[model samples]
Target chain A: MEMSAHNCRLVFVVLAVSGCAPPDSTSEEQLRPVVPGGFDSVPVPVHNPLTRNKVLLGQQLFFDPILSLDSTVSCATCHRPDAFFADGKAVSRGVGGRPGTRNTPSLLNIAYHQLFFWDGGSITLEHQVFGPLQNPAEMALDLASVLQRLESIPTYREAFEELFDEAPSLRGLTQALGAYQRTLLSGGARYDRYKAGDQTALSPAETRGYKLFKGKAGCLHCHHGFLLTSLRFENNGIAISKEDSGRARVTGLKEDYGKFKVPSLRNVAQTAPYMHNGGMATLSEVIDHYDQGGREVRGKSPLIQPLGLKEEEQADLEAFLHALTDTTVLAGIEGP
Target chain B: MNYRNNIFIAVNLMVLFLVGCDAATSDTGSTTLTLNLNAQVNGKPLSTDPGTTFDVNGTLISFESVRMYISEITLINSNGDPVSILGDGLTVPAKNEDDEDISHTVQDHIVLVKQDAGIDSYDLGTWPAGKYEKIHFKIGIAGTNNRIDPSQVPAGHPLAKQTDYNNHWNWNAGYLYLRIDGKVDTDGDAVPDDEWAVHLGTERFLRQVMVTHDLILEADQPGILDLSIDYGEFLRNVDLSDPDQRICHTMNNLPVANAVANQISSAFSISTDRKRTGGSTSADG
Candidate 1:
């Protein structure tokens, strides 16, 4: 069969055990399977092409704290590669050590997401970049000020001109950061190998646990796609807080209260302190919360029903979830 | 004598040809219309500069800023035919790379009335010279335009991210149609202390305001349609002294947002002022 470059890359990812080369040493062409799977159709916005130079510039900008007002926190501070792109914190701290309202979500496989943030407030990946940079509790830097700062730096200014054929601008900043994040693809979990025709890839308990997750646990209702997210806003019965009304803040509908975007389950094991508010600390606790059908709240989804699983079954389910982790992403980690 | 007479006759014929029948009669030519917004507080001239205090329900309130979105403006003629004011064809950035050709008219024909920025007069463009019965305009942004992607738009455009003093809400995916930021004196001290921001928006809060006038436009003449908005009338029922009634961002404080939205139309009055003859209408506050 004639295969497109993207389809060929997907096949290559599945066939090769070590699908993606490490981030630091990999060349531009070798960056194809940054995420391994059959997700050939990555939703990269056409306006911002995923060029190698742009991605490199974006990578530097992502780690640079100059975007913040205090120059102390970077995008990498909250979304750490060591922790599967999610900070292992209940709520992320920003400039001046101000606590954010929502948990820092993982950036792994973010290209697959249609909407951004817990409330699905931002429609485009480019649209989402302005929030944290200007949010007073976060970076605390205005767009005009940030542009001036970036413009003063010869390196950023030269790079922006070469890549975008323009001066350092709002478009250049958003597009660059977005391009770099689209490359943070995660795949090649043991579960992926099992799905790729290796029957013995999963242990007997993991296999049984996967069945329960799809069947009795009813996780497949929202977490079913290859990226393991329906990519839709849903009310999973998280306790409603008036200070943060979740999706209702965006849609302005009372019926949308307590709703949040169902995040992808890829690299779930590493991205600890789960849920929108980081209310749950562990995967087992998360599973337990779901097992009990979550907190009783207004506008809670009916899909969340009590799963009557035993202790052993719950343990197996947690083990199965661990199988979803991309071990290569955690290859060189030494400490907690 | 005959040659001089022939030259005079030729000159007269040339003037008739160059001027055209329409221009000669002064009945079919067009004129540019300018809309001037005059802001006031209880019949006095209003100033949005900080420390410019005004009386609102016996409380001294100083406005930090006052801005609103005006869109879908139409002028009703003597025959009651509506004339749409075509804007200068301004645009924001494209949402997609391929959509470069698409005119981002979501903000076109719309004016951001920012009194603090000293931008109050808007050129409504040239129109056929005649009389109009009334003027019509909406006080807030309409659907689709409110939800425009501000990221795509360049700075300085009316609907750009930074234009309305950061009026767009990053968390709500919509712009604040009308934003009023001020400080109120709660304890009877003349100096203002408590800061208040009344951000009115969301599709449900849109209000349409119409002003009746007997305006006449002369051929090739610039006309000014003077409009006045009273801060006293706008804060009619809302007691700014009450701590709970001071602030609103639409959804968070629905009561204050509703009160402001309900009082929008009554705040505005128009002056059918003829710039050529310098005449004023009775409603001119």
Candidate 2:
């Protein structure tokens, strides 16, 4: 608990000192920018600078519901802890029974995320934050009115006063939420431990799955790196066009017509209803989608080729993917 | 709150002050040279285009947004003998459209913007610095390349809609060096009906090297140098029409890569006729 607070403070320091640092790389990973109080993906928007006070302040706003229309739902409502900050329902219920087009992606390691939406439209975590807060289907509150709502609450007003010395402002609200979001970094998984040099961490099946994923399975093509995602957009060889325009809407390029930003499988087993349109409900089905080269979308990414994985290999890969499960970040995140 | 902390703060401030003073005094006696860069893109000046150009062919051309970039201006003192111009080169904008409608022109419109025509001018505090002689430059990527995953390049630069460019290669994690397109008569039909677009880039043949030479300038003489890029030669020399010799844009192509690499490098001949690098880049690439 205390560790997260320190990480939050470190995040603030990174934001404040962003312009001075290089973008997302380190001379050595150990020498990363200290923020909220530990190291993770370099604190995003180093220009915004996170303060322990700011993150603590942001968390209060995240759960306060004061920023919502009816004051009934906070960002944490659908994004609860027990489910990796993602509501496990095929589609999460938003403010006043509003249903969002895409499933609630797990906010785990979101600070390390490059593009925000499944279609890769919202380019930054900060930019995407506004969508949920203002979407009539989501929190159902306008940003312009959020400041007024915060000021109405003495708790929010006093909290802002103690953290910023000034009353609540739009910038303050954003900075606070941004700060709080950065602390939602969830790692310490089997893969992280293995990469950090605990060779014995993975079980036998998981080890084979990891090997297959990196080699023949080609899962690593989109799901690459320590962040577990190359963060690229692809058609995923599934029929994703019926629902969303996919990445095509963001980039009007015909080639990207059915593409969508590949979601990180950090806690994949938990966040079900896969694909940008939530067409695949199980991991096995998703692997099956890749086994057959994506349906003939006019502009499918050339990378989406048929893998032809055997039944056992596919099952083993799923087992290995399950090792990515991280229960800590989703449980009891909000507390004193 | 502690006395020692206060003393540390004072020491730090003193150090910063000393560094600032040293920086100010060390460099001196150079004239400020400013070049007003004017680029007339696609036969029409920047003032003309409704801010977008239409391309007829290529590997899924998403004209949603685009930008272009060219830096490292080596001003040549074409006066007497060959003298290389040097000093500070300021890349004013931070890489996108939000900075201005101009920076994007540097990143996109590769088919249009030029060093002098599209790139405009340069000012080195005053006049040209160093032994100004013949100038040389590469029309592409510089070192301090944005090392981070390019995912945020869109947010950093919302103006050009750069987030939409899928010219990147999935095989390797890098952006396509260049994308060139135009109708090609593979069978030599009089009409350009047999359409083909060249997709170039990736780690292999990223060498679309464009260079300049023999630039002349005297104190009293006119010093505007223009480079002519004969697109005709680009098509012929690069063999844009030959299907066997030319690489097709079927997700990947190499001969087309080699051809563009060879032609664009040799096609850009420096001439003294116009002020900038040649005919305005046809914004529709």
TM-score of 1: 0.85
lDDT of 1: 0.76
Q: Which candidate's TM-score is highest? A: 1
The candidate scoring highest on lDDT is 1
CAPRI accuracy category, model 1: acceptable
Q: How many clashes (backbone N, Cα, C below 3 Å) per candidate? A: 0, 54
Residue B60 displacement in candidate 2 (angstroms): 41
TM-score, one value per model: 0.85, 0.51
For residue A25, what is the lDDT in candidate 2?
Answer: 27
Residue range A98-154, candidate 2, lDDT tens digits: 887877787766777655677765544544565677677778776557767778789
Sliding window of 10 residues with minimal summed lDDT for model 1 chain A: A7-16
Error of 2 at A299 (Å): 1.6
Proportion of true contacts reproduced by candidate 1: 0.46
| Fnat of every candidate, listed in order | 0.46, 0.00
